[model samples]
Target chain A: MGTVAIYSLFIINKSGGLIYYKDYGSAGRMDTNDSLRLASLWHSMHAISQQLSPTTGCTGIDLLQAHNFDLHCFQSLTGTKFFVVCETGAQNMEILLKTIYELYTEFVLKNPFYEMEMPIRCELFDLNLAQVIQKDRVALLGR
Target chain B: MIGVGKAKQYANVLDKPLGRGRQEVSLSAFAFLFSEVVQYNQTQVDNIAELERRLEDAGYAVGARVLELLCHREKGNRRETRLLGILSFIHSTVWKVLFGKVADSLEKGTEHEDEYMISEKELLVNRFISVPKDMGAFNCGAFVAGIVRGVLDNAGFPAVVTAHFVPIEGQQRPRTTILIKFAEEVIHREARLG
Candidate 1:
């Protein structure tokens, strides 16, 4: 998928629960159980990485590079994590994740019916996420 | 600017100047915060009326603080004593500082002596929300209505404030009208002052 780069996006809440997951036409899509397990695994790995650091104030893993793809992780102040798996050495992943965080805050957190620290069900959030990821991440910065 | 690349210290938070009673918040940021306010209130109530009342109560807190803040900073410590004077203050000064623009229209009711209306084409809080078909006759503007009520009550002009959607024939989105019906004492005092 040359035109569409990102494989999938997963959002983990403060307590390491999978709150949101979206796959943008990946070759192999994981089941919901697999997705939840992946989220919990990432959360623990992030914590363990911080402890493994020699010096103090070490934040968890920011990027994990595999032969096939790259995984980028962004942690908010409140411990919520947003990770995007994309094509190898994908550009502007940081910017993309940050914008997604903003979208999460606006559409999901702001929605009156939405329960906090739960699975995201807002239509606006889904629509906005699709638009941002499908297009070039750099282009969305003007907003 | 004095201490670059250093943490600034304050003796007391209250000792700082009020800073011209104007602040800027990005529209997106404001929308998110407003949504949180709505959502928090939603979890606490069951019925629509209760939800609206809770939202209004939240707005009232904001309005009361805003009145106190503006009265000190903008009006040189002189609070508005007249009904028209206070309405103008809210319509212009308070609206400008909080919402970045004045309300669209402020008019006295045609039939009622004590009633007044402040209309906004698209209230900032209502911008992103599209009320569901099932949740009929519910408007997020109730929070703003509470704000108006808060301001009026704090100013010693106790009134009943409510928000309604007034449909305009050609417009796609109906306008929000904040209706204020003054207490009997306010009307009597106004007549005495006149």
Candidate 2:
């Protein structure tokens, strides 16, 4: 019925360039240049976080947030980022982000068609995600 | 590993709760680990069939251990002698021990006496799996095949388990049928024994 208020999603490469982007909700609300620049900046911050990582062989950044929107970034242990963007006030975004990461790890990364650093194109991931987001949206809208 | 003495002591301390004797674990952990296994195999093999083989091997290993434990629980009772008997034992005891449920259906091959089929509406590993278009060559069913191989091997019946996504005349979720063909020697021995 309804959907989760996930504004957009992005995937940043290890080097911090924009690799993938998708807007699930109504678009044109945020400036395109601003989002891209933010992605770039977060990429840098993620790199810094990686440097500060106590564990050796640790990969990309995770769950970086700004004032207007929250950014959740999951880097594979190999340094690929799976990013999710949601409204700043969204509830339990972290759990949803973790669930998405789990799905990616299970469906996308495990998929032989999914090459490293390539964009995800697993049908199951998309379908299950849509269902989860839709449920969240309905709950949010109802509230 | 916990020492036998410690294990027994702990078991004694928690007598009432431990009386049930079985432990429940989070299925999520198993799913995550299984996902990694699929990914690791995907990296090594080029084609779907090979990947399934790898999964089957993995399951075979687990099955061997499961069979030993099940028998041990039975105080090291001898394995089943007949094909139907062994299969029935696997469907009920082995399946319940591993997957927590028996397979959906167990049918004899109409054409071949030595061949049998186990159909599962929802396989444990494939329950949450959605194959990406790029990896169209691979099937999640291989892991299930591996599980079957494991169960059979432990029961002293060596067989080849192949996973297939066969669409029946009317089915919603893809039906995964594991085709089990016992080794020629096994059937030959059965005939000789008779």
Candidate 3:
């Protein structure tokens, strides 16, 4: 349970450029170069997925799993990415992503200070996100 | 029998269609729709003050129509005459008509005769809002201010309604209080009548 932490969140523009990024929890979790590289790679992957998609409009990518960790990327119709990184066996990943999406819609996106395609710095959003992740940890511990 | 027939005929002559009967709306629907309206306006507006002004204007429109409908729905016998009388009427009757409940408290300014206030522990539009830090300039209560303005305008009491978040002790969510300042003409008229 303690092993899970949201390393960062990123928003990718439609053309596959890194628009925003924020790192939470432990300092130096991901280096500057790594963060930028990951964002660019994810942006390109997201665009490719959209182009290859038979259906019209943008959608989300399936959970990407590797040996060390897992990357969960959810995209909005407008091509916004709500990226979450967690342990391989982390439960309720989908629910966590949905809740973050809801928070972005209500607090960040709706907030006037949040410029389009800019990084999010909403205190309320940060607090809510922290609370949600903590709750998930507690639930996992109880189980 | 003759008198009853005459009353019925008079009612028929006076009755006029002002649109459909009152429609029941879900509180959730109003809350969500209003939240969207605030969000939509927040995007276009430049600052907190302008956003609030736009919200007040929006509420003013609704208030005008709501006040008229409320007066029309009354039995037509107990119309308000005095300034305070109409102010109370606006607080209770008009508030209930729009928000489904009267405001928590209504008070007249102690120092100024023309100033009044309506305090609600939790204003409806702000119930779910947690203003993002970047958008520190946004406040959902502007919509409520607009509604108050509408009620005042429709009632022929031109006034400015400003919604503020004044946290009170033991309150969880931010408390919204609407300050209404009446025009000098209203005070003058009240004084003359007295």
Best by TM-score: 3
Q: Deviation in angstroms for A85 in model 2?
A: 5.8
Write down the TM-score of every candidate: 0.61, 0.64, 0.70
| lDDT for each residue of candidate 1 in A1-143, tens digit (9 for 90 to 100) | 25657889999998999999988778888999999999999999999999999999999999999999999999999999999998897788999899999988777766766778988876568767877875764343333
Backbone clashes in model 1 = 0
lDDT of 1 at A70: 92
Q: Which parts of model 1 have CA positions greater than 4 angstroms off?
A: A44-60, A105-115, A122-131, A134-143, B1-46, B58-90, B104-139, B150-161, B164-194
Docking class of 3: incorrect
Error of 2 at A116 (Å): 5.3
lDDT of 1 by residue, B1-194 (tens): 34576546679998866666337878877777788788777788899999999999999999999999899999988999999999999999989888889999999999999999999998988866656557777889999999999888999999999999899998667899999999999999999999
Per-residue lDDT tens digits of candidate 3, residues B1-194?
Answer: 33565534435645744444555687556656776677687787787778777777787787777766777776353456677878788788877766679889999879887788889887766654666655554567777777777867666677877877787887444678888898898778788999
Off by over 4 Å in 2: A1-7, A17-20, A25-117, B1-47, B109-114, B127-129, B153-158, B167-173, B183-194
Off by over 4 Å in 3: A3-5, A17-22, A31-36, A47-61, A109-115, A121-124, B1-55, B74-78, B82-85, B108-114, B126-140, B168-173, B183-194
Q: Give the clashing residue pairs of candidate 1, or none.
A: none
Q: DockQ for model 2?
A: 0.25
Question: Which pairs of residues clash in candidate 3, taking residues 3 or more apart in a chain or in different chains?
Answer: B56-B146, B59-B146, B59-B147, B60-B146, B60-B150
| Candidate 3: residue B51 lDDT (0-100) | 79
Give a tens-digit lDDT track for model 3, residues A9-117: 6666656656556665534577767777888898777667878988886564658887856778877767677777766766677788888788777666555445666
